[model samples]
Target chain A: MDFVNLGRTGLKVSRICLGCMSYGDPNRGMHSWTLDEAASRPFIQRALELGINFFDTANMYSLGSSEEIVGRAIRDFTKRDEIVIATKVFFPLNPNDPNSGGLSRKAILREIDASLKRLGTDYVDLYQIHRLDPNTPIEETLEALHDVVKAGKARYLGASSMHAWQFTRRSIWRTCMAGRGLSACSRITT
Target chain B: MLPLCAAEGVGVIPWSPLARGRLARPWQSATTTRTENDQFGKGLYGATEEADRRIVDRVSEIAQSRGVPMAQVALAWMLSKRPITAPIIGATKPQHLDDAVKALDVKLTAEEIEKLEEFYVPHAIAGFK
Candidate 1:
């Protein structure tokens, strides 16, 4: 698969990112971006045929069930290292469980471990903050993310669906901004 | 422009880069007229007969002169813009992709671009943020 740097990070992903919002379940009402497990194989097979190696998924997407499916599908089917998997953290898995979500230091640390277990991977290529946490200090989020990178749990970090605008609409400038979040996903695009 | 985008390293994937099957014949939507915002809106064809006819004619002329699909002319214009990393083309069916790929190699000159732009210049396009 052809690789391109994702944003400013040294980490590179396929130019064609397969979006997996279509891969996990049927209740397409709450977070409609998903595909059921049964339909995931051919979808993945086709993507591989097209040289698509990067995928995107988030915890908020089907509340983490999507992550499990992506992790299991890839591990059980394709060669692990050839394809890159990314999933996100943020939205609550259980709305009633307040401590379960957000970007607080505690939330990020705990969620990263949970995401690691769910993803069934020792280290993520790009660990992203699914969304910025207003409740937690940016320093804490950055440090937590930095710590993960230092510990080797996550290889690098990236962000998505961000509202933060880059001044140069033309240049692919790579800056280590202080305020931002990261998310991960594994694509099975049709 | 492609050089500019390349210089800036801005990756661009133009959505509806070909105006949703409007560039090709056996034109998919048959209502002839659709809500401007509906996926198959005739806004591309022209708001009025005179206007739409002009749009089609401009595309048709360039398409014929270039000896390629009109959609190719459009994609070529974009690829001409170069630094475009990719185009997020929507494919309702397989032919949609087949049709879009046609424009990959058609490079439009500066004059042709200006002419095509003029054809639809009068349309009161709406809703941009």
Candidate 2:
């Protein structure tokens, strides 16, 4: 696989990233089509064999089973430091708890630790917000993510599936904050 | 979004570059277990299906002409864009991953790229907030 720098960061990632949303327990989450752990391991191993070093998963994927499966497979298939593992927050693991999701400082702080535990890793290569939280101020989310990087829980910060203007707003806010801008941003252009 | 990301040097890892597998096959040719149950994927398209179908048709034509899986054509089109760092590919089968990796080598000519993108209409922002 061809490796390239992830944006301006020195971190090199493969051109093809294995999305782990499909490698979860089907019975555990809303996606009934997800592969079980046994069926998923060979694919992860195959990806490693193909030289794909980047893997992306979300906390809400299979209600966290995706991360567990990805974590275990990565551990068995390759060295932790040799690959880039990315996970996201924002979706609530429990719908009953108001603070269980979003980009609020409290939610982010709690979710990061939970994700780390599920992934069986101390620090994720990249931590992302699954979506833009309309309720939270941009500054609050950016600051909390900055703190996540500061705390060494994640090497980089990212955001996914937001409007371009919203992303520009966040980027401008980060520019003002200086050294707090996101290193990556994901979008779905259907 | 691509321009802004290019200017800011933020890596753009787009999700669903295959449009939830819509671009990877003939227009509405078949539905998988995911398509049958993916409510989220359902919400992502349909608003512009009339227009999107033309694009899918073009992808099919190109794939057929090149003797490759439709996925390689779809992913090759995405990889041609300068701002894209990597397109996150979800694979349930082994060949799915193999097809994605092979897409890097399936270079689209300038004319082919234009043909693939010519039918794109601005979709109502789907996927997330």
Candidate 3:
């Protein structure tokens, strides 16, 4: 498994990332479905053995079961520095709570802590916006993410499910580029 | 998948070119794995439906005669199209993976490729709705 550098970040990950959305899947959603730990462990181990160091999960995956399994996998078997962990913030971990999810700084900072707790790590390799929130100003969102990195809670900030055309229209990520010590996700999907 | 990704620069990972084990028949996997249903439990592989069974038979004939797994032929055709980075190959057992990988080396002739497409045009089936 040849490792590909994720753009200019100097961080390299295998082309095949372990998408553990199946782990701890609870309810069957529209596009995403679920998978239990028993059915999922083989694939995760196989992916690692096959040289996949990138793991994609979210608070939404089986309502954080995916993160739990992934965190457990890394803690129980692999070293911390050997892999890059990416997770998203923007979905309601608690369906009943209106303020549990989104890109607002309060929400972003709060959810970052929660996601860290679920992932069982102090910092996430890449903390993504998950999806664009029209309600949260990009400045507020990026600044909050930068604060997390400054506090040593995260190394980088990134996003997923953003359409390419949407990325082209925004310059806020450019403001993110000018800062030191924080790199955003590459605009590529795998 | 490739076309979608290329237009978006999104990476392509195609899955189940074999119609979820339907391409090669006498499958060992339960129909549940082929297309797990909602609470209803009705699925593509459960009842030996007509259109699907015909597809299984036709693809099998092409693969057997050409000395390839039907899965490989189907996937190779997809890979042959542009922009796919990888296909999510699933396997219940070792042989399933073998069948998928074999298609990579098969290299269908232009004529054979056309014939396969003519036979199976990727029609939409029920239950997707």
Q: Give the Å error, residue A167, model 3.
A: 1.3
Q: Which ten residues in a row have the lowest lDDT in candidate 3 chain A?
A: A181-190
TM-score (chain B only), all candidates: 0.60, 0.97, 0.67
Q: How are the candidates ranked when ordered by lDDT, highest leading? A: 2, 3, 1
Among the candidates, what TM-score does chain A have in each?
Answer: 0.78, 0.97, 0.85
Task: Give the per-residue lDDT digits (tens) of candidate 2, residues B37-114.
Answer: 999899988688899999899999999999999999999888888778999999888799999999999999999999
Please write out the lDDT profile of model 2 over residues A80-187, one tens digit for every residue. 999899999999999999999999999999999999999999999999999989999988988899899899999988889888888888788777878656878888
The C-alpha stretches of model 3 lying farther than 4 A from their native spots are A25-33, A169-172, A175-177, A180-190, B1-34, B37-129
DockQ, model 2, C-alpha based: 0.73
Flag regions of model 2 displaced more than 4 Å.
Answer: A188-190
Residue A88's lDDT in candidate 3: 82
- Per-residue C-alpha lDDT of model 3 across residues A113-147, encoded as one tens digit per residue: 88889889998887776677777787787778778
Interface RMSD of each: 9.3, 1.5, 7.5
Q: Clashes in each model (backbone N, CA, C under 3 Å)?
A: 30, 0, 2
Tens digits of per-residue lDDT, candidate 1, A58-115, equal 6666666667767787787677687777666666677787887877777777888887
